[model samples]
Target: MVRGKIEIKKIENRTSRQITFSKRRNGLFKKAHELSVLCDAQVAAIVFSQSGRLYEFSSSEMEKTIERYVKFSPDYFVPGRPQVELYLLELKKEMDIMVKKIDLLEVHQRKLMGQGLGSCSLAQLQGLETQIEKSLRIIRSRKAELYADQLLKLKEKERELLDQRRRLREEEIRETLVRPMLPVTLHTGKDETGSACRMSKHSSEVETDLFIGFPATRL
Candidate 1:
């Protein structure tokens, strides 16, 4: 008679649970061994009992199988290689590139300082001379431009001084022309009472001895 399928649930009785665990674990190991031998496939199994007993079987070395699983499985944890390792590798590549560039720069600097002339061909020497001449020309041109700017500033200052002097001289001449002249006073004679008489003279008139006599004595 075909038996009904057993309900897949935990065995409640302690003794029955232990018996079922032993039988099922041995059967699983037997099937794994047969599959490995018949199909030439690697198989591994692990069982843990309620009493904390360990049971494990492997077609090959347990460590080797676990290592292979880690290599092929996407969810396995790998030691010694993490996200930080990728960053470190990229950093090392950049450092290598920088070192190469530094070496190249040092060589170029040595060539410029005339320390390694023996390795340079005639064409390279000519090129170096041309580059130096171009750099010198550029420097001299900049220097000349600075000198011209300074000379222009000095010329502007001199012109300002000349203009200031001219303005001061013109102001002086204007003040002189606008000034008023004062009249001259002269003592002409004494009166009969002994009081001296004075006369105002025009600034343009000439003095004469005829004006020195007393007015009463004069006609």
Candidate 2:
């Protein structure tokens, strides 16, 4: 009959448990040695019996393997100290300092904006006033620059508008020059007074100051 597989559980008998521990510890050491030799791998194993006896296996020196483990597996190498946790602790401390600095800066900004002045001392208030004066100077300087820029832009726009007007006037003059002029014929007749009178066919009924408002035309 074939032997059945053993169900793994804690051995209840003390003597049996001790025997099992001894056998398993030796077997584990043997397996570790075989794996190291077969795979050309660095291996280390440590065990402690219930009686507080140390058992260990290593492909090379135990200290050397441990050093390698610590080097590669820095996170779980030492029980008391974790390198990653130490770095994170330092980072957290730096973050806390930065947060405090930001908070102080925010309070300073609030004071500069004329808020939160109730908690300030006389000297603090004076310092804030100086800062406000400095800020005002800077603001005035920037404002002047902006005004200058706006004036320059306005001047540029004015020049552009003038150039456009000039171009339009030149175009109008060109069209006028190219136009064909109409010939005028004067017809003398006797009016109600029976005096010599002249009438123009092209003249409108409403009179205009032709010399002042219109170009001189050939009569």
State each model's CA lDDT, in order. Answer: 0.79, 0.80
Candidate 2, overall lDDT? Answer: 0.80
Per-residue lDDT tens digits for candidate 2, residues 10-63, read 889999999999999999999999999999998999786765445678889866
- Mind sharing the TM-score for model 1? 0.43
The RMSD (Cα, Å) of candidate 2 is 27.4
Among all windows of ten consecutive residues in candidate 1, which has the lowest summed lDDT?
A: 194-203
lDDT of 1 by residue, 88-194 (tens): 46646765766687687889888887888898999999988888899899999999999999999999999999999999999999999998987875645655433
Clashes of each: 0, 0
Instruction: Report the error of model 2 at residue 149, Å.
Output: 1.5
